[model samples]
Target: MAGPEVTVVIPTVGRPSLAAALAAIGPGPEVIVVDDRRDARTPLPVPDGVRVLATGGRGPAAARNAGWRAATTPWVVFLDDDVVPAPGWAGALARDLGGLPGHVAGSQGRIRVPLPPGRPPTDEERNTAGLATARWATADMAYRRRALEAVGGFDERFPRAYREDSDLALRVRRAGFTLVRGERVTVHPVRDDGFWASLRRQRGNADDALMRRLHGPGWRAASGAPPGRLSRHVLTTLCGLFAAALTAMGAHRRRAGRAAARIAGLAWLALTAEFAWARIAPGPRTPGEILRMAVTSVLIPPAACAYRLGAEVALRTGGAR
Candidate 1:
């Protein structure tokens, strides 16, 4: 019988790193780059023998769906546009999938995140490092085309680069398919996404809400994610809002409001300080890092709670009514 053939699918938003990613793959195992830029008027510049598809700015889930559905090979591998495949990756991928039994639906590649040398990593670097042990991160994962078809590919409702892979893995497993770790490795370089990246990442809490609605409260354990701090965030956010409300109302001569405001204000400050310390404790404690953590820590709880609340309300109301 002929050996199993594989196609590589990378979803991109026109990042400059796509060029290096393509170069590292080096011309084996048919490659498809999905351009997810919503307003692209021109095609992405790719070398000959590489195919590019457009998903019109849909998120990674939709982009990957477009790529895999267009593939004819039995196996479709999903790679992030910023990751560099290890040398001889094509052959390693072949080896990883060559003898998989029918019940085995997917193979995951090991991920390595390179941090700065000679010092502990910054908070942002540490966040990126989490991908190294992330379960079923599509940064470097392969799935049998039939298996993908069976589970209906990624859930596009995720709308962001978080939690979709875990959701898919859960569904595939529930469908009686087994996913295994493979020897193939990929390097996920930590790109500096500016100072507010951590705060910005709180947007993923919305997806977590969707995950909860779809998979129930045990979704975190089932998806291999560490226990979350949503409950704490909710409390922190409530305290902050209550503090502000009471303080504002106190200006109208409400004696009880003044005392309650002090208590809520103290609670908010204590929670925010603890959250900041937790992040700063394990990171490089330079002045800049400390400032970033302190500022973002105060802001993250409210942002997370807002996103989660918005998503939950939307889910419960069918998002329209």
Candidate 2:
């Protein structure tokens, strides 16, 4: 079949890599680049023949909605600006979509994350590598336009790109369309991030809570997601807080309270140390890496718990469900 049956939609935030991504796509499909950059001061520039749409700084879900909504193709393929399509990926994608069955609503392209050379991958690298096994991420995914429309496209409630794709995939599946993996490959290089990057990522715990509220508690099992460590986090955080309270109460010379506080404090320290060591063992073991892992591990459980609690309140009170 002559190509162009699939329209490529890329939602970008003015990343410099966008040009390379477009270049690697190699001329076969109608390409639309949706600029989601909130900075209205400067516009994203694109090459000739590639259409550009501005979403006025909305998140990617909105940018993607605009992209696909403007497209007039049977299949709308989404690619992240940070990824580069492998050689001949366009031809492979054309075939990937064209060969799909009626019941197949979306096809995910295979993703390869190149790790840093000469060291066991740090926790960040390991996390980035998990994208390869992700069931459905839009780094390179093509969906039947009709299926997208039927599910009302990506949910804008998920402001961050973290869970938005998974939310859409879940809804698409619930609408009775199965998603399949495709042969097309894309390279999603791990970008450098701040020391607190992983720590800040705990904000996604709230997204997980929203997912549970919208899809029910069984959503994880239904979606094939592994059981997470939320329960352990909750226990760790509570133990830490309890230990602190007991220590404070015993400050006034109460012997019994002091003994209890000592026991609880030891338990908290043991859990924190064990969590930190697990992250440290697989790391590069540099001083900075060790410090980051130890500090973040101590902080993550409480932060995650707090986010989950906040999400429960927000979702239950009609916030972002």
Candidate 3:
């Protein structure tokens, strides 16, 4: 049987990075860009010969589904607007797809984040490119159109950027198909943002909770996600604080008060050290970056836990799919 024709689908928030992505594709492959932004805000001009579809501000998951549905080809490669394919990417993809077994439903490419020399990755850079190994982002992945149809495309319940790709990949795997890693590579350019800006952008925790509800408590770690050390840190910090407060109120009971205060102080220091070292030891940073890390470190634990808890609760309560 002949291999199916490939169509490239990109979902963009109208970032300037789209131009780089467009320039990377080979000639004659049908490329569709789903514009998720409500207004024309991207500074990059649309390349000629590429089709642009407006999604009326729907999220990436929805935009991806729409884009795939509009594609006439048998295979669709989902590329993020922020990603640029490497040289010969299309040929590599075509060759890979042609040799795929019947049970293989999708393929994911390697994503390399181009960071400045001598600079450690910022939290934002790490988050944007998903520095963790073992899981593939939709930015450089391709899916079989038939498989997508069978699984009903991406789960729209994943409102934010996180977990949606994993969720889809999980479902696809469960349907008795293999998702292979391909030789096709893409460069995910690191975006420049302040420490606080990156922290504020983590609205995906809610979607993560939803994923847990849909999959299970083991979903995070099972899906190649890092351990929820942040959750543990937050819990420990809260316990320490409570112990200290109780001890302060019971100053008349000197023995217990002293013990409680000691425990609380120890816990607080431990959490602080862990947070600071994680950011600092990765690489050399400017004084400003170090200060930002120190300040943001205190806030990340609670913020992350809260988002995870909220997401799990909402999913259990049937708030989102």
Best model number under lDDT = 1
Question: What is the overall TM-score of model 2 with all chains considered together?
Answer: 0.95
Q: After superposition, how far is residue 305 of candidate 2 from its true place, in Å?
A: 0.9
Cα RMSD of all models vs. native, in order, equals: 1.9, 1.6, 3.0
TM-score of each: 0.96, 0.95, 0.88
Candidate 3 runs further than 4 Å off: 1-3, 40-44, 126-134, 240-262, 319-321
Residue pair clashes in candidate 1: none
Which lDDT values do the candidates have, in the order given?
0.90, 0.88, 0.78
Clashing residue pairs in all predictions, respectively, total: 0, 0, 0
lDDT of 2 at 170: 93
lDDT of 1 at 297: 95
Can you write out model 1's per-residue Cα lDDT over 269-294, one digit (the tens) per residue? 99999999999998889999999999
Q: After superposition, how far is residue 286 of candidate 3 from its true place, in Å?
A: 2.4
Off by over 4 Å in 2: 1-4, 250-252, 319-321
Q: Which predicted model would earn the best TM-score? A: 1
lDDT of 2 by residue, 42-102 (tens): 8667888999988877888999999999999999999999999999998899888876788
